[model samples]
Structure formats: C-alpha cells, structure tokens
Target: MVYELKTKENENSVIEFIESVESPKKREDAYRLLDLFTAVTSYPAKMWGPSIIGFGSYHYKYASGHEGDAPLTGFSPRKAKISLYLSMEEGTYKRLAANFGKHTRGKACIYVNKVADIDVEVLKEMIKQSVNFSKKMGQS
Candidate 1:
C-alpha cells in the first residue's frame, strides 16, 4: 500500500502562521528565520503542514520505498523550542553542532529555545549547505 504524506503544502499564509506563535519573542524569531531561510535558499517561504515555514523543495526516496517531496530546509516555532529541519552529512552536522550553541539535536533536526541561544552564522551555513545539497540531488 502507498502511504500518504502529512507534510504536504497547504494554502495557509506563512505570515499568518508565524504571527500566531504565542510568544512575542518566538514570533520575532520566526520572522527572522523566515527571512533568513528565504534569503539563503533564494526560495519563497511556504507553509508545510500546519506549522512549519519551509523554503525550497526536494524529492527523496528512502530505502524502505517511501518517496516524498519536502522542503530543503525549514523551521517550526513550537511551544518549547524552534525545530530546524535541515540536511547535512553526519560529520558536518556534528562539527556544526559543536559551534551551534545551546541546542538539542536528533538525526536530522536541530532544536533551539530561541534565536539568541544559537549562532546564527552557523545556522546560515547549514542552510546554505542544505540548499546546495538539495540542488545537487536534482531538485527543481
């Protein structure tokens, strides 16, 4: 059976979603991230699912036969922290994470409490690398 993707694009406005973030500080950081992602990726911000603000796009097919399209990079301002969705080789992620400041990490996500909690320059470098990787992967 084919699986459905929950993170497909929606018609909701990105600005509207960012504005809805409860914390004033988080809201401000959301806007900052939106601008930074757009500028770095050179792609318009688009709403992914109900919360994530995404830039660019890439298609991936995993070994398990799961295939889907996703933003090259994105972020969601949640109640506890900001979740950054980016793609980097494992070694690169580790190196960057060392300089990324106070943040948590999963296999592919970086979590920060606020923009001030991390190094924006490292974040920008990650974004640039993610976008370049996506392009090299043949994303349109």
Candidate 2:
C-alpha cells in the first residue's frame, strides 16, 4: 500500500516562521540554522509542513514502491528540541555522528537542545552527504 506524504513544501516564509518561535533562544538558534543550512546547501530556505524549514528537495521511491518528495536537508525548531532532518540512512555515518556533539537521534531526525550543542562543521559535512545521497536515490 502507498502512504501519502504529510510533510510537503509550501509557500511559507521561513523568516516569518522563525520569528514566531516562542523561545528567544530557539528563535535565535532557528535563525542561525537558517544561515548555516543555507550556506552549506547553497539552497534557499523553504518550509516543509508548518514547522520544518527545508533546503533542496528530491523525490524518492523505495523498493516497496513507497515514493514521495522530501528536502535534502531540513530542521524544525520544536518545543522540546531542534529536529535536524538529513536524508542519509541512520547509522550510515556513525563515525561522523560520534563527533556530532550532544544529540539524540532517530532514523532521520537528530535532536539537539540548541545549535551550540553541535559541531557546526560536522553538521555541514552531514548535510553535504545527505544532499548527495538523496540526489543519487532520486536518479535511480
């Protein structure tokens, strides 16, 4: 069975969204991430769903035939933690992640309390790899 993708790119203002975040720290960190991601991905910020700020996008179809469009890299300034969304397979970068700094992670989302908790250099490398990985997958 095919599942519909709930998160999608929308015509929303990323700056506006950042300004709406309640926490002053989160809001500032959101702006920092916006600059960081934009500089790394070299793509303009785009909103994915109501919360996530995304960069470049690509389409993917799994072996099971599940397919959808997704950002190559993105993040959401959630109430609990900032969610860093990257496209590489979980654990595919264990060595790299070891130096990624204070964070918890799931399959695709990395949770961080703030930007200061992570090594920005490591995040940049991860974002580059993720963009390449997603682009390659879409080409297949």
Return the top candidate by lDDT.
Answer: 2
Q: Provide the overall lDDT of each model, using Cα atoms, as 2-decimal numbers.
A: 0.87, 0.90
Q: Per-residue alpha-carbon lDDT of model 1 for 4-54, expressed as tens digits?
A: 899987779999998898999999999999888988888899999999888
Give the deviation of candidate 2 from the true structure as CA RMSD.
Answer: 1.7
Screening candidate 1 with a backbone cut-off below 3 angstroms (N, C-alpha, C), the clashing residue pairs are none
Prediction RMSDs, each to the true structure: 1.8, 1.7
What TM-score does each of the candidates earn? Answer: 0.92, 0.92
Candidate 2 lDDT by residue in tens digits, 33-120: 9999999999999999999999999888889878889998899999999999876755767877989999997877889999999999
Residue 119 CA error for candidate 2 (Å)? 0.9
CA shift at 72, candidate 2, in angstroms? 0.5
Looking at candidate 1, what is the lDDT of residue 72? Answer: 85
Alpha-carbon runs more than 4 Å astray in model 1: 137-140
